[model samples]
Target: MNHNQQSTDGIHEDDAALSEFLASLMDYTPTIPDELVEHYLAKSGFQCPDVRLIRLVAVATQKFVAEVATDALQQCKARQTTVVKDKRDKQQKYGVNVKHQEYFADSPSTGMDPASRDE
Candidate 1:
């Protein structure tokens, strides 16, 4: 194979392109959710297990993390937007600065106990 020849991929990547790709990979960190981690661990089906098995699970999960994260982000945004919309709807329905008297119910003590005072 010639040094400057185009590889099977069809595009001839120079050293700079390869270097840039490698550099980008260095900064690439997959954001896997805790739920996925738990699911993977549970699917492995073991107590105090082998390191190789753990590594295998991690490697397998790495491929799906990007897709999972993208979907999770979309769901999160939808949930948050719904919550905000619900809050606004409630506020509008009840009127602005609405305060329930039950929330400010009478308390037993103001600050200190009655017997503790040096009166």
Candidate 2:
């Protein structure tokens, strides 16, 4: 599943996390050198070295994204076992709400009853 060039399983949800991913790209994978990458950028009239780093980083990033995505998929599938569910049955799962939910008791049966809604 380590198809780095593929689109579906290729990328990670967080693109920013890729640069810090394990293993260097140029060292492990086929890619341009950092110096050459900068050369191309400079030849193209780009001034910032950081911008060049961005390009090299993309390749460096692929390895981690692949590793993470595969691990995540495996973990999720592993959680699907009946044994896991049996254990979870005794555990109460809590749902978090980021937004307030409106509540009312015996509030109304319709948008408005003219008599009841009138101030």
Candidate 3:
């Protein structure tokens, strides 16, 4: 096929896919209610009488919120994992030294009471 024919075919395929997606949107119910979407749209001074367009807006908003929530959850989990890892690393690196210091500080051989050391 010529380059022009190939480009034309690609455009047709894209149009078909977009039509299919729009058709599917008719049957798909978004998590965000249509009433809420319509109310918000109306409040924002946007007027659309078509139910399909409202539904499309609702679906898009739902998808955007879901994506943002998923990203936030992933970031929270990653931050928690990093915090836990850092704590474990610090403990592993200093656990023995801390314990040893406590032991020696309280030892009778030191002849210095732990409470007096603070003075």
lDDT of 3: 0.88
Clash pairs detected, candidate 1: none
Better of 2 and 3 by TM-score: 3
Candidate 2 all-Cα RMSD: 20.3
lDDT, each prediction: 0.61, 0.60, 0.88
Q: Which ten-residue region of model 3 has the weakest summed lDDT?
A: 97-106
Top-TM-score structure, candidate number: 3
Which has the better lDDT: candidate 1, or candidate 3? 3
How many residue pairs clash in each candidate at the backbone level?
Answer: 0, 0, 0
lDDT string for model 1 (29-114, tens) is 43454345556677777543443344444445776776798999999999999999999999889776666655442564545577
TM-score, cand. 2:
0.27
Per-residue accuracy of model 2 over 36-103 as CA lDDT, tens digit each: 65666678787664643545554655556788999999988887786678667656564455788887
Residues 62-85, candidate 3: write the lDDT tens digits. Answer: 889999999999999999999999
